[model samples]
Target: MENKKERYQVALVSEDQKINEDINFFLEDRFHIDVFSNGVVLYNHLTKEPDKYDFILSVSGLTGVHGLPLKETIHKLGFSHIPFFLVVDKADNDMIQICIQNGITDIFIKPLDKITLQTRLDFQLKHPVVGWKKRKQEDKGFNSYKMPFVKRVFDLLVAGTVLLILSPLFLIVALLIKLESKGPVVYYSYRVGTGYNIFKFYKFRSMFTGADAKLHQLKHLNQYSTEKQEPSDLEPERQEVKELCEFCEQAGGGCLRPLYDDNQIVCEKIFNARKKSDKESAFIKIKDDPRVTKVGKFIRNTSIDELPQLWNVIKGDMSLVGNRPLPLYEAEKITTDKYSLRFLGPAGITGLWQVEKRGRGEMSEEERLSLDNDYVKNFSVWFDLKILLRTIPALFQSENV
Candidate 1:
């Protein structure tokens, strides 16, 4: 028998009694478990006895104390070093990404299986980032998505089937992108993935070549507002960009009668438009970001532009379903433990974030972060496929995919 000192001390912050009981059943065999129904009681207990557990698992949508906000307060009070494994039952891609970046050590979905639960706990005990991943493989009961190897087969099958069916459309898109844009058809980018690993993400180029070079000049959008702001350059830019959008009505060719006077009329209108557009609107979004080109807008709306990421899934850089990958700057917004939990899975192509609260022309860093946490806590393969299936409907609604 292993020494009790070597055993992991885990604090499960879950409101659901069945889940708590189930977790205890699987964990009792290998861990010294202390479970609580909510964050307040657990937090108070921690205050009373400062260092009892080796790791902490914080569940999103808990009773009384909400998920991400609770994490922010906990980190603020300087209990940050204690590992926090986040739990989510309902969340989107962006929310999960923020969680991993914040500091969440790990994440688990509800109705966790016996083996998976043990695997995660044991892994964490020896390799605890936040909670423990149990090393010893012991199964005393029914598995949720039982058969680890079978799960892998399903993932491959789904990935393969999607790839085969979408091949023609993928080709057509590639050609159209090449024909429409001067740059490469598929824009490959170095993005961070699970374990902070860097992987190349593919997307239909929505911006012109040297687009990144222009980001510095276009950062002017960030100059808007920030009472609801954090310490991020990206925050300011979002507002600034949204502020700059009044001209979009004109840019998108919306709400204006076309005049055939001359090119000078176009230029004059464009100039006047930019100046007048610099105002706060009811719907915090820039309708016509001067940055997006005609092709860019179309690509964004049709959702065709995002299709290239399927290749990322094929290559195993990402999963068919999981949290969205963070573009370096976006990842920095998360500054708490609950944030890191989002990064636990292989980054995904279409995620809970996009299907639920997509860029919709106006989503905040905080809102995205919260949703990411929720997704992480509630991740599952079945859930992933279901989200992917529902995603097709959203493509029609998307301005740019």
Candidate 2:
């Protein structure tokens, strides 16, 4: 008697009913497909029965919860060992780069080519990702027998001494904060740190009470917001581009091919025209923000706002030198696994980026993240000391804090 081959279990997440049907029809014969509509449902199911599925296939921009964020959640849940494949409508250079960073096994762009997908699936199955070797290697030094101990001891000694000496200054700052603001003197911010750990990050309140409520009013002041033209302003140009796209599609060319190909003169012209209209920057900075109070300006400029974080360091919520802990909103933006490596090291009030750039308005978001990754990859006791020394000078620099 011959033994029957065991079928591979695959989980498919897509909000589109038609896409789900198509994927199921194509894959059901060879694999057991568990279909889900949104990332939340899929995530809950996976958490309960992670071992049931061999891999996951998800749509990139699902409505309820997006794929990249879903992947981040999975990693946080300690289920990163499972492989993921994302399906996208049009894979641009940025999207492809993001996918690569997120540890996606493969990307299947729409008008899904069934044959190519099958081949890719077969290849992935044959070569399953046993572990994230690169991330492991980057983290190895920090995780070694002696480094963590040495790092913690240094944090204790330094943070302890600073708190003791700064106690009087802390009292003065607390009183000033109370006189200026109606809210608590110390702002306890919710921040995401190493390994997706959540902690209350301490800082002096550098903005007026209810400042967060005024964010919408200040959107125009956000330096990172991409400049936009009113729809009416761009309608004619958009129609022209639409016609060009249709022409290319009719001429046996892909709708997205022109956008991806720099050699396409027509495409390049239209793209450049559109590019000139949209001014985008990744880093957000507002010149002389009105949200800050008079005392707030002084504290932020002199880096006094960061003093209360010494308590967090002593409490073991952070280290003296590591990646800066991110607010939940900011952390959510960094969903890619490659960018997530920034979380492998400890969260700190000051790190390589702070020492190197001192909140220079010129630093791009990617550059900042890269510095965090660099610190993780090359962290040592001596390196930390050097960064600490450099931080002293940076504290006096008159730049955006």
Candidate 3:
């Protein structure tokens, strides 16, 4: 069967009809364009189908509900992963900075010539909203350094290489895990990785065989770290999620809800354990987790368990260097502002602060923000190399590496 051509829908909202039409006329050859007189109308469509378009273009200087308002609204919607462009005059530096701070797609300046708009548009299409999409396209493969590439390539390469060279140590650990526990050899976790997609992360099984099932039972103890306690809505959508074993155990699919769809063959949801946080958006770690097995502690502490992610790098599930991939629970924080731009690129094995302050855990989300932002702004292949070298000695001092 022939595959359907991918659809690329775009929105352009501007006060000037001439400019709007010009953009439309120019873009028609390339995309499915939707023109709006202002941000209001465009926002309406977006709200209806948050993922409706491939891109959104909001021009500056709308008298009421300016560009910033529309962008913030999208941010609130938490669909900040969608690619969006800002149209403005070059003199609008303040607005540009605000857009940058919020992680808006690059800008399109006023009096935008066909060449520039097309160029910027090309870049957006080139860098899709997620990793799976990027790898699917013909963009250049991974670079160990730079902006276009994720920031932690250096860390990944360094760590992955070391692990491969020290495979015998991992073998010893594997044997110890077997000697110490009666369980599966590896712990396969369905974690939310780069692109917010779930992947089975491999680690020498550090926890007990059924640790996950006991998490709820341990909730009271785990809840002690209120600072780490996720917001109310962060848990699995239990009403919606079909528990694997329970579902299989039930005679009639465990009695579904009113909104159940007969057509959704499985109708099972794996609501990620890591729900994106709803706060200022700076949590990427699962702290002092009770689900961690005794063997898990040694691997996690020595940072030996992350070796499996090297497969992610080879398979392009992640980059060697970039922002560390946060679980969905960590998403809201990055998208919210603490490190908004940090989410713009791929998740990494090690990144800016990972080599520097990740070990001490001394840096606040803000400090991490500064380092990540600097990486994005000044990213390059060589820069990745420098970070890679800086990471060598620092790995001993850090837990993230």
User: Which candidate has the top score in TM-score?
Assistant: 2
| Model 1: ten consecutive residues of lowest lDDT | 135-144
Poorly placed runs, candidate 1 (over 4 Å): 1-151, 220-287, 359-361, 398-401
Predicted structure with the largest lDDT when compared to the true one: 2
> What is candidate 2's lDDT per residue for 198-240, written digit by digit as tens?
6788999989989877654555665555653222322122122
Q: What tens digits encode model 1's per-residue C-alpha lDDT throughout 177-226?
A: 67776887777876655534456788888777887755544433542222
Return the TM-score for each candidate structure: 0.47, 0.61, 0.45
What is residue 2's positional error in candidate 2, in angstroms? 35
TM-score (C-alpha) between model 3 and the true structure: 0.45
TM-score of 1: 0.47
Distance from true location, Cα of 258 in model 1, Å? 56
Better of 1 and 2 by lDDT: 2
- The CA lDDT of each predicted structure is 0.58, 0.70, 0.57
Candidates sorted on lDDT, descending: 2, 1, 3
RMSD to true structure for each model, in Å: 19.9, 8.8, 17.6
Q: What value does the lDDT take at residue 59 in candidate 2?
A: 72
